[model samples]
Target: MTVERVEFENTFAVLLEDILAELPTFNIPSEGAAWVKECLEYTVPGGKMNRGLSVVDTLRSLRGEHATITPDELHKARVLGWCVEWLQAFFLVADDIMDNSKTRRGMPCWYRREKVGNIAINDAFILESCIYRLLKKYFRQDDYYVDLLDLFHETTYQTELGQLIDLLTAPEDDIDLNRFSIEKHRWIVTYKTAFYSFYLPVALAMIMNGEKREAAFTQARNILIPLGVYFQVQDDYLDCFGDPEVIGKIGTDIEDNKCSWLIVQALDRASAEQRQVLHAHYGRRSAEDVEKIKQIYCDLDLSAVYHAYEEKSYAELCALIDQADANLVPAGVFTKFVAKVYKRNK
Candidate 1:
């Protein structure tokens, strides 16, 4: 690991302690407190930490690489970064249940663990509430505290709205190719994944740095939204083509009736016979049905299509970053993000 990554991981223990230390104030029984601690530990820290780490990375880029960040500033950045992770954990717990997912981060979904079952739903809520609790404890006195609150709340709402759009667009009971389109796919990813995953961390860093101008945010959004859309499209592609062990989860987008990028692209280019095959087998639970859909994706050359989209997206993002107003936010802030995600495998 890089020195910066080591530093980032070391801080996680301190923050976890800070969070658990406050559980007593909630007047929970000892067992309850322990359970909450376990839930947080299990759900929050195991991922690649890209989204959480981006907050610190953005802060560094905003301040210049050689500039020294105060210890307090570093701690606050870590806290905000974890808040983003917490927000993600909140969404994933509920999402796993909704999607009936089997695994995450190479482990069984929290909701599927013994004794955790449906109760993971409530655990998801607790995960979300912790974001505000951390905000109130650590950032409450900062001048931009309310902006931080507004940012998290608005991002959460956008993600939930995106989830709603996705669920409605691809309801398992209904299989209609007409309902799947590139436009609808874009909307689902833009709201569901882009805001929280791409936009929120940098926005948090900008707010902490006291750069609250509307124009700066607008400029950031234009680039980050598309960056996020590209990330989710990669996710959809990986779900179909990626190695399950490497990705740490079984791909279910096809069988779950998800309105995935591949599906929409296939719908857009499919012949009538191919469309009929998809409509029959797209959401079925049978392995044979899934293979049929995979065969169709192969025949359609989706792998090549995705690669082409990946290239175009990288070029477009680079162009946007080059065109951005550096007086508002440094181009490196955006460039570093693109570098991290472009052509990523997991």
Candidate 2:
């Protein structure tokens, strides 16, 4: 890892310690608090922390190159970064149960742990509650505290709505291709993945910096929500085409009946016979059937199609960033995110 990445990891460890140290103040018994700490360690830190790290990145960019950020500022940045990650952990713990997922970050999901079955649901709630505790602890006196709280609540609701649409789109027992569309794909990606993943961290940074004007957030969201959609599209493409070793998870969108960009595009281009082929093999677990569906994708040239969409999306994002109101939020904030995500393989 680079020096900066190591620093992020080390700082993140400190943030966890700080959070753990505060747990006992909740008046819970020591045993219960210990389990919650273990749960937080297991769920919060494992993923590639791009969303969380982006908060710090934005803070630095906002502070500019010559200005030395103080220790207090760095601590606040890390707190917000981990807050985003903790919110994500809240969602994932419940989502794994909803999706019946077997593994996450190459280990059995928290929900799948022995003796942890239905209790993981409550644990997910606890994880979410901890966000407020942290915010209250660190930010209660800040002028933007209410804004931060409202932002998180609104983002959480948006994500839940997106998840609902996704579940309705591809319910386990119901495999209706008609439910899939480009519009629906956009909606699902925008709400479920984009809001929290793209907008929240940067928005948190902006609020942290006391940029309370609605126009700043409007400009950020305009660039960010679409960037988030494009990111999810890449994710959908990667789920099928990326190296499992590199991506760190086996692709199961095809098997799981996901409303993936590839599938939506395939449906758009497919003939009646091709559609029938999909109907036969779209959601099967058999290796042969999965291969058959993948064969259809290859024949449809979805890879080339994805490349074309990616290029167009990248150009559009560049234009938006180029046109961003640097006086308000700075173009560099959006540019930083685009640079990290665009054309990324994992």
Candidate 3:
């Protein structure tokens, strides 16, 4: 895993080289170029990188032995993997600014950096622009190039729409139980998190391997979207119940007015008094209020609810993968994602 991670980091260097080479064509100012480099380095790398690396893993599972794969094939796989990471960086940079988040990946968010602030918004756009740049430079001549471009564009738009829903549903300083429905929560997770995080990687891998059938993409989406939603549900569970040290961040969903899965479930299960408790404490930043909402969750037995949901979701994903068209996508590609997330704490 360490060696693989090292290679992954090395690929970022290759991507940076590509960006630098392309910079001359744009006539960027010297200071602007340096800041762009810094922004890319700061926002793009780090983190667990599971989404990016999953592309390479899925491709390897589909294509057989690493030794048999040519260098060009391996390079394309890694490039696509990094493209997912770049896409994430783009979202996260803007998200931090919008969320007023202080930190990401255990450091100050790009928007919160000492020398950078609102400038990170433009940096986010630059991060997004790099995806097409990298794609055109590497895969422009390939048959699947346009498909890959469309997939990324569509996935990005879907994610932004999800973000719009999320922001609308849980606006800062504007907590309302009416907007925190289970249906809204699921829609937000499906578009915002699942499409880009889960489906895009597998879909990109499929395209890389020359599988262009619309049915194949649809099949991958059918299975992966729910898997991605389950993953977000787990994330919601962890935010309230998980150890901050273990999860690597403090849980603030309760105070952030998030349409969290737990909160949605709580609303479904809460009685009049319990619902009142939520109305008062759900989005406040006070530790006392956060704990009050958590106590309500405990009283409602949401932990048990999450466990049951996990088991059911895992089974459904497995069944879908089992029935997927083997010619279009290997079950292993989906199963690997399932195994990693089923009972994961971090």
**C-alpha lDDT score of every prediction, in listed order:** 0.93, 0.89, 0.89
Residue 37 lDDT, candidate 2, scale 0-100: 80
Q: Which lDDT tens digits does candidate 2 get at residues 230-330? A: 99999999989998778766788888888999999999999899999998889777899889999999999999999999999999999998888888888
Ranking by lDDT: 1, 2, 3
| Residue pairs whose backbone atoms clash in candidate 1 | none
Could you give candidate 3's per-residue lDDT for residues 12-92 as a string of tens digits? 999998998789788988888888888898889987899988998888878865537777887888899999999999999
Clashing pairs in 2: none
Candidate 1: tens digits of C-alpha lDDT, residues 167-202:
999888886767889999999999999999999999
Worst 10 residues of 3 by lDDT: 61-70
Give the TM-score of each candidate. 0.98, 0.95, 0.95
RMSD (CA, Å), candidate 2 to true, equals 1.6
- Per-candidate total of colliding backbone pairs: 0, 0, 0
Candidate 2's TM-score reads 0.95
Model 1 TM-score (2 dp) = 0.98
- Which candidate leads the pack in TM-score? 1
